[model samples]
Target: MSELARRYALALYSVCPDEQTLEQTAHVLMDDTTLWQTLCSPAIQGQEKARVLARLPVLDGHGLLLNFYRLLAEKGRMTLLPEILEAFNEEVLRQKGMARCRLSCVRAPDAAELDKLRRALCRLHHKQDVIFEIRTDPSLLGGFTLEIEGVRYDKSVRGALSGLGRQLEERRMA
Candidate 1:
């Protein structure tokens, strides 16, 4: 995320400190393409965009968020909303003492297998909890790869084959 987005996220997260409101705001920003597009459009005047935001049901009880939308509109920074939301979510996870991991494999594991993996990852990383984002990648061939805190552990069949190929190429050159 850009520094600007992170700053905005930190400001919002600090003042609101409510996950449900932040989540609802994220949904409004992401799920409503028309609203998002209108907000981001240079053609729309700030007052018009404010009117649009004013009518949003999601912003009903969220005066701070409504003002935030106006500020973004006035500043013409609606384009930063997605990145801001991402950073905000990261802050939320940090506050909850949780870590996010990405698990890529050829197929998803069963419930028990997933639970075991979650426990193992938590113990390995010394985290209270881990939230997994699982992806099915057929090119992985068989095994899975785990990514945590920007570090990727590659145990996939495709990764092994590629490593072996590199070793063979190095021997040939030597």
Candidate 2:
């Protein structure tokens, strides 16, 4: 499924006229759950789905992509929208020479905090720019965990307690 999505994304990226349009189209697809469901619903026909997609003003200037989207719906591959969006985002970042980091915390960060985090991640990766995906997971218990480039850094309270427990167990055995 993901491979198919990647292929579609690459095809779109290849023909995409401008990065801004690609970004806007991707945002529309990513943010519209109802539209996604409608597109993927067996009840909706290709013409109906095409009409709905055409109504979106953001996609107005992107005729090629809009048609591509219609084609996916017609072929019943509309459910791959999410994966295709993901791949498209990755392609955009890759084109821009940036890396994305996933940061999960117990609560949302303020603008200043987020900026600081972005800077820190940029420095950590030695990259001029970094993209961040911030999410709140209350189960983290406090603090946050950062995942990037397949490496994970766990600083949550649960992680700390687990480390402490391991240290105590080692001492008891000694």
- Winner by TM-score: 1
TM-score for each candidate, following the candidate numbering: 0.83, 0.64
**Residue pair clashes in candidate 2:** none
Per-residue lDDT for 156 in model 1?
Answer: 91
Q: How many residue pairs clash in each candidate?
A: 0, 0
**Residue 147 in model 2: shift from native, Å?**
2.1
* Window of ten residues with lowest summed lDDT in model 1: 21-30
Candidate 2 runs further than 4 Å off: 17-19, 22-38, 44-61, 106-120, 123-126, 136-138, 162-174
lDDT of 2 at 101: 86
lDDT of 1 at 152: 90
lDDT of 1 by residue, 116-152 (tens): 9889888987888989999999999999999986679
